[model samples]
Target chain A: MLSESDLGALAITLKLALLTTLILLLLGTPLAWWMARSRWRFKFLLEAVVALPLVLPPTVLGFYLLVALGPHGPVGGLMESLGGRSLAFTFTGLVIGSVFYSMPFVVQPLQNAFTAVGRRPLEVAATLRASPLDRFFTVAIPLARPGFFTAAVLGFAHTVGEFGVVLMIGGNIPGETQVVSIAIYDHVEGLEYVHAHWLSGGLLLMSFLMLIAVYALNRRFSVVQP
Target chain B: MTIEARFRIDRDDFSLDVDLSVPSRGITALFGPSGCGKTTLLRAIAGLEYHHDGFLKVGDRTWQDSDCFVPPYRRPLGYVFQEASLFAHLTVRRNLEYGIKRVPAAERKVSLQQAIELLGIGHLLERRPARLSGGERQRVAIARSLAVSPRLLLMDEPLAALDVNRKQEILPYIESLHNDLDIPVIYVSHSPDEVARLADHLVLLEAGRVTASGAISDMLTRLDLPLAHGSDAEALIEATVAGHDEAYHLTHLDFTGGRFTVVRKELPVGSAVRLRVAARDVSLTLEWQSGTSILNIFPAIVDEVIADGEARMTVRLMVGGVPMLARITRKSASVLGLKAGKLVYAQAKSVALLS
Candidate 1:
């Protein structure tokens, strides 16, 4: 059986993951597309930056983000001056943290997908009298379908299971920043073995199902169309 | 009216620079060897080569100039790539409609039905490109381009990706476009057979330069050009179906030169067609030889004679103002006394009907 706090933590974790995944998709699409297609000589520099979250320690990223959202830091200072509270230790802070923590999981797959679409289809559309924007929507998006699926699933799952970034920036708070991973950590630290088992087991099953869905759906897409 | 274009493109490994003015109504073949910048020139005319510097004037509309540039989508033109790059996700019908929907209704000149009927692709409209064969896909691709009713059509080796049988399967549909549509075509090809069959005007390119450009007949017969000296050198003749000899199973084709009897063909009387007479298949005689097996014998005047090598020479003959080439051994030429202004009989042993 779960406590009320456990359910609240689960709900918060789901909500955070959903919001973070949505934001990543909206922001990462064009970024990934540019990374895939642009011919700039220094494009690899931007690629390296986007991939930083993958190689860097999560606590290092979270430490920097925490300072940036703290009361005296640039973002938090700007927020205070704009008549808003500091973003540290809040639900919004957790959302921001998870977005950065899961950035590579969403962007890398989308970039690879966009690259796979290639220049031929876009050039074909152009010759057929389609403008650049029209070609991107009509040709590129539909062709990169599998990439979107992988990005969304990986983003959501990675955010749901995040521990270091969430802990550093979003201290555990019931109904706010108290996500599933943090709740399970609290249970283990307090010697609540049974409670930890239930949340940990549920998370393990959910993550496995999400990954399975991505692989199975992506394979089907490749087989049916490609 | 004519299409006047001047383009200069520079690349690390190659460069293209040329200025041309071609008739706006006939099939003008940009003929060249592989890596001869033929496709690059076609792309420049289509506005796909963005970094090129030049001017493109298609009739009254200027697609590109020093001060202005019209992107490909804004230009009223159709382009068919080497491969039939139909949108894999869309059904054939949707692919055909993709460009038509972009053009306004009043501006539409070619209806979707006309394109479908022209390419004979009515049955494959509901199927996706993946379900089509190579020839079928290319036909659908051509139809998709024609659906937009473009004033100019550019094709870059449209049959290069297909096998020989597939090329034969798609050639008739392409030939029909010349008869049924008024759009001027800039066809890029390396195959001499395709150019001889389809082109009225020829632009020869070599090493990113325009080697020759003129009427196909003139270009193919010019002694200075490589085409005249090649072993496959031939003459193109535009003819009409004069009559059919059912008793002998032969078809009579009447051209400006004269009538040619070939194996029977199922064609209506007065239908226009093209004929290819290879130079090697033609033999010159001092007089009309009676009782010869050859059926096409016409009185020809020797316009020019040039020694091909020590053993052979090519004789250019004029029959009723139409030019023909006859390749004969130097011994035969000497024995027959063939020279300029000499009256002779050109006996054509084989005439292949092109269309």
Candidate 2:
């Protein structure tokens, strides 16, 4: 009795998670690197800002993102003027919201990883004639591999399980923006226990499997290093 | 060829101001106590630290000058940090090749095989740095640096993190590097023994200033420098193995001034060696003693007798044009009427053979 709408929601959820993870990686890498290395007087200010999403209620973040991506908001107005539509109630809007929702999950791990790498290996690379970019790729990135793994897994899992931000921004549009979490919620509201069981159980199993993979791989990596 | 550097770096607590020019073919040690800015000076020379007014010219090329500075990667130099700091992600072979592959083919002077063999790290090539012993990691680090075929090599207390056994194990490779490689080295160290054994030139740093800079021999025996006043005060003499005395199980060595017979060594004849004659080990005699147990004796002319605080006098002597130090009580100096140009005999209790 599953409808096309349910399958579309599942696909949208996967796409949102993948896109959010990608965007978080691209935007979070340099930010995390800076957070790891900067000794600036106001460094704590930035750290506090990045960590705000971690402690704040997801609904609070969703409410803000909705406001920011609405027609009157700067981002929405910019997109509107660029010959597009308002980001609110769109798949793109869901991705932007998920990226914000999962920002700390990706960045904190990467930042800690980069910081744990210390300055010695980088100095050694420099003396070995590796340019700054070359050193980052050959030394820092490889040494911080565990951090990347953890970040990616956490970002993906966190985005996949997202509900409040998607509900606030994407408005649960069928075939376009309804994600798996919203689908499960809708099924439960309509008193469809069987559908809710399937979607919620799938998400629970997926998240658990992802976490198990991270812990297992991270343990192996650490043992290899040790 | 010479490496001339004039660096002035101002920090919150300390400032490094040094003007040094060392020959481009020998190991020059930056010797000092902890927090003396020796590492900072070396980092500046390597272009790893830029917060300073620095000028560095190596032979015909200018590495850093006013308004012109080369980054570390472009400066054609290899630097070894205090810790081994090997790339954790790369295996030993990849670490060695990291710089080797970056250099232009024509400029690669040290082959990978040669470097691996030189540092005795051929067996460890397949292993990551995490799996290595402290000594093994340091050796690989050295090999990695050497593979770059740098014009200069900068080592900042490369053995500071090693234990005594590890230091002994790595010292020979470093000595060979000093001997075999044509690249000049600027080595930072606080250990006097390392400076004595490895350095041809010495830059003495104290309180962020160049206290003294010269050939190692002159720097070690200078009555004005702190090196000549400590328990570690010793004279470094360059000598060549002359021959072995089969009957007495002794070895004959020749220096610029005279000859010395010490406990035999296995080195081949004519091989150059360095000897450390500690000031405490040297006994002053006004006349040549015939039957004393002390084997090595040399006729020396007193150059100066410095009053070492309290009742002792540090006697500076010129033995066949080579300076030597003898520590004796002021009473002995007065009784012997020791003065400048007074001829004396120096009987050594022990002489260390350093190579």
Q: Which runs of model 1 end up more than 4 angstroms from their true locations?
A: none
Clashes of each: 0, 0
- TM-score of chain B only, all predictions? 0.98, 0.98
Q: Which ten-residue region of model 1 chain A has the weakest summed lDDT?
A: A217-226
lDDT of 1 by residue, B38-67 (tens): 988888888887754889999999999999
DockQ top scorer = 2
Q: What does candidate 2 score in Cα RMSD to the true structure?
A: 1.5
lDDT of 2 at B355: 81
Clashing pairs in 1: none
TM-score of each: 0.98, 0.97
DockQ of every model listed? 0.67, 0.75
Q: Fnat of each prediction?
A: 0.55, 0.78
lDDT over C-alpha atoms for residue A126 of model 1: 86
